[model samples]
Target: MTDNPAPAVVEPIPKWHEFMVPVLRVLSDGKPRTRRDSLTATLDEAGMTEEQRAVMLSSGQPKAENRIGWAMSDLTRAIAVAKPERGSFVITDLGKDLLQKNPYAITQEILRNIPAYRDYEPQRQNVSKADPVDIAVEDSELDPTEQIERGIQLLRADLATDLLKRLQERHPDFFEEAVVKLLLTMGYGGAENRGRRIGGSGDGGVDGVIDQDALGLDQIYIQAKRYAPDITVGREAFQSFVGALAGRGATRGVFITTSRFSAGAIEYAKSIPTRIILINGKQLTELMIRHGVGVQIAKTYTVAEIDEDFFE
Candidate 1:
């Protein structure tokens, strides 16, 4: 008998908009239910597999739960669902009418058509040139929170691409210095941030070093490679870095590159006795963004919500 393969651990959960109809159906009887109970009933009614229900967002909440909550929020904004009591929801007359019309599915376009939903939308000074229909369809897939996160993700990805390209265009010495500054910003060079680039001729294989304390009793070695995005730093490169560390009698080293590392190089670093951290092009750019090394924030947004404590 052949053994069956393991089931896939993660599966795509329904998008926030897709849950609108399901949430409405769960409350169609007009009986009020707590948010927790409603979500559980909706989950069962949707016939989601265990894997789908088990998926989680980066924030650690279950993905299905978050989407369902957003759907309920949208329905509430449309005057389709009402919270008769705190944490308890019931279908309103408008919701029942909506459900009767859209038994199988409800699109964001239909919700936007409701004057209440449009009125609740945040007032914006800029008007989009895109057709309302197309915009509705495009925005329906992700909830508002997700839409914001996805927008930021896309912007960061574009910035990373541009940052990597710019890094590759600079002199090799510049990259070495940049990595050193990144490490210092990351708190590796102590309070004084004492670190520098030592990549010129006759210097050791390492490009940079960080003095963690006054006497330099603790130090970190860094190797920076400004290879093109398509290039892969292989195991031989890691071997050279390792040899350099050994020559210095050091135990910790960081290898930062504006390119990817081969699988062999990663495995080699993992198996070695000396501690080695690998930072590839993607990771390097992300670190640069996080540390505010080469980028500046253009804007900031604060998402506020009702503070129930003040009412009490």
Candidate 2:
């Protein structure tokens, strides 16, 4: 006879109340403390492991830091917590007041104390309350493939927005380099000689010229724009750029901008034979982020596929 297989283990659910109960207890025992001190003490007193603490603090995944960070922002805005110095966080007077009460009351009581929270509480509460039920219902109703596709789209958009924000914050120059590199990656002509000594003044709107081949024979014109918010490329700008390309006897031109093109400009470019390809700011950011041009992933998630053969 075949031996019976071991039972499959089910992961336990993470309770926010369990996490905050200990956190509040730790704070109530002391005046004010840093996260490290408070967390360490709470874990020690509760006789929990670091992994268990992580779960309690962050819903049982390694993404605890990010979740806690977001929570800190909300708590800070509510005046329940305050960061007096860099890398140091402590409970505020309001936090202490809340800590004196039942741990289960923390979320609502804290929100009730803040005027801004009170004003936005209904909408925010609705979202938090509805999200789990909505997600459960959707998961049951939709095909798994459709859900996966939607998740991928959301992740891509979030990654693009994050990459753009980081570029604006840490490496502004790299953003310009990224636009050029993206153009080159798409088979534009300006890759030779480090994109120099090609187009001269009065060559129409061509700012850079890339040879179509290695023999320095045919060329394509390029116009790059490093634009900020509220700065959109217009039809007049596109017209001027096309005029320059035509002057150089080039039928193909790439107009790359870190900002979006106006509707008229897009329509005008399509109407011409200049073969103008426009890369708007949003698309550019998404491409850069996807290609890892100037961004790095701080964390990674590995999703696994089930092995159906094992069940059989």
Candidate 3:
């Protein structure tokens, strides 16, 4: 074989608008179709090549498939299709009537005309333009530049959820260490003020602590939990944590869990005299992901615009 191989030819992916009508048509019968079936139906009807199907996005999702997914999302937003179940969707009565009219192109203009889409307009910037069709093609909820940021935000959310699941699988000691590392990432401690994991050492209710200053005058106690979602942290846990802080003669504490806090738990934390910060499963993962404690940068892209100052 030659050292140089021919570059694989990449095929084009259709825009979101191109997939809208096909998605509507696939769901028009009112029979529930699964997510995979729906995407396949649209792509098949549109006659995309295998090369196009094989193309992958930076997020590892197929570009054409992602755009098709966006089309289905747009349809659901317009109430053109109803997702009555988790993975499957059915055409609503409104959707059926819409299919009967047979719009040549079920464009965003048609979608925005729906009352639900209009209801969201008050919060959006007032862009008084005569052409509704142009808004769909030209205007982005976030501009084209911002679309990159939006995609990265979505990717990070998926990664965070995965990291939380993995964290739950680890040992309690690991969880305590992860929280300390996360705190360090959040600027809680530096060379002068170091954090320590004390859970495995039979430390009291407190699992870890971060000395806030070099002199160690102030410290933040941590109580870490690797509980599942079904296991909610109740008020008792918070009260015990407060008692631990009292034992340490400390006023600041952080209660972190890989599960949600019960309503009573949240209330008790607020009512406690000590400063108790609650970090539930969702919040914990978000913080870790934000501070780069458990995750690493996969890729980076720099987007630049014309510097107005340079032009002046």
- In model 2, pairs of residues that clash are 189-210, 190-210, 204-244, 205-244
Q: lDDT of model 3 at residue 37? A: 96
Name the lDDT value of residue 269 in candidate 3.
74
lDDT of 3 by residue, 1-312 (tens): 659988888767888778877887888767899999999998998888889999888879988899898777666655577656567877877777766775557766675677544422222235453434253443465677656655665466455545765787789989889999889878887765489899966688889999988878889999998995448899888889899899989999899998788899888777867898998877887788778887888887787889999999
User: Of models 2 and 3, which has the larger lDDT?
Assistant: 3
Q: What's model 3's lDDT at 120?
A: 27
Error of 1 at 105 (Å): 29
Best by lDDT: 1
Q: Count the backbone clashes (under 3 Å) in each candidate.
A: 0, 4, 0
Question: What digit string (tens of lDDT, one per residue) describes model 1 on residues 27-59?
Answer: 999999999999999998787787888888787
Query: lDDT for each of the candidates?
Result: 0.83, 0.57, 0.76
Q: RMSD in angstroms, all models?
A: 22.3, 11.3, 10.5
Q: Which ten residues in a row have the lowest lDDT in candidate 2?
A: 116-125
Backbone clashes counted, model 1: 0
What's the true lDDT of residue 296 in model 3? 89
lDDT of 2: 0.57
Model 3 poorest 10 in a row by lDDT:
116-125
